[model samples]
Target: MATAKTEKLSASLEDYLEAIYNLSVDGSVARSKNIAQALEVSRASVTGALRILAEKQLVNYKPYGYITLTKQGCIEAQRVVRKHNIIEKFFVDVLGVEHTVAQKAACEAEHAFGPQIVEKLLCFIEFVNSYNKNGYDLHDEFRSFFRKHGSIAAGDSN
Candidate 1:
């Protein structure tokens, strides 16, 4: 379930929150310059986003001070990060997408999918993992199929 705070956040703000959460994972708070560097946005843009996040009670921010996530912010950031990871894993592990391409795609897709879809994707990844563990190798099979047929269509046969 999305919190009101998270629901109200724009994708850009969510990105900022995720960046902060990742930065702070090293046991240090995030600075504005670091956030800017992470997101590839300008320092002014980072300041503006930080101010908005602070107003929403999503971050502990003071000008020129290290920033940290509030409890709610951490929850929301975790949600975003989870979505990104699930999508990236699906793309890379299941679809055989390049890691860099999957990373970029996941960044865009993370904000678009809701909890239900994300959960389903995670479950699907688990199912694929199980299949691989059981010696099924769905990923390899799909790659071979794609190489032969170029694409799957209705009534396609092995």
Candidate 2:
């Protein structure tokens, strides 16, 4: 719902938004110093990012005041969080990737894929889950096949 302006956010801004969302999940105030620590960026960098986000109406920022996400900002941040979760699950559950590796990979991928691809992936994951839940064995078959032969290729002689 808040994605119209969110679509214009750079990846770095998206990261900042996500970090703010995560930090604020406990309903505590998110200070600039905390945001900087969470993002491993300098306070000056956080200040700059907060200013840009404020201009976009994504954050409420007053110099020396606590920073908070505007409703739109919260929505956009949650979207990023959801994408990261989905990608991590897809990697670990479907591809048999290790959890730590999947987490790192998901962070990179969440920003790379567009909505259509993400929607398709979500559908595919749900289908696979339903299939497995109904006593089908596609999960094991796919995992075994991938382990044996990596990614499938076109016109492969099998």
Candidate 3:
């Protein structure tokens, strides 16, 4: 289920939050220019987004000043980041997806998935990890099977 706070945020806003969170991870406050570069948006766009986030109480923003997430913003940003990482992990580890492709896909999918689907994905990933720990690499087996069969046709029993 999505929280009311996150529900009110657009995908663009979420992206801004994610970018700011990542930029600030090195213990430095994020700058508007850095945010614009990270998102590949214009400085004007970044300013607009920062203002909106500030109004939502998700960030502390001031003109020509560094930006930082509020406590609630950090919580929301962590949620978004967690969903992205979990999706990326599942895509790469379970589906045998290439890392770059999975990263791009995760970025797009994170904004759309709710907590329930994300939780299920995490469970599935954990299940796969357990199999690996038990000396059965399900991902490797799947990759080998795919390589051998290419694409199995419907109703084909080979």
Scored by CA lDDT, what does every candidate get? 0.87, 0.85, 0.88
Q: What is the lDDT of residue 111 in candidate 1?
A: 90
Best by lDDT: 3
The local distance difference test score of model 1 is 0.87
lDDT of 1 by residue, 1-158 (tens): 54535346788988999999999998887888898999999999999998999888899888877688988899999999999999999999988777888898899999999989999999999987778555768878888987897754436221
Judged by whole-model lDDT over C-alpha atoms, candidate 3 comes out at 0.88
In order of lDDT, best first, we have: 3, 1, 2
Please give, for residues 75-139, the per-residue lDDT of candidate 3 as tens digits.
98999989999999998888877788889889999989998999999999998777865576887
Candidate 1 clashes between residue pairs 3 or more apart in a chain or in different chains: none
Which stretches in model 2 have alpha-carbon errors above 4 Å? 1-7, 150-158
Residue-level error in angstroms, candidate 3, position 131: 1.3
- For candidate 1, the per-residue lDDT at 43 reads 92
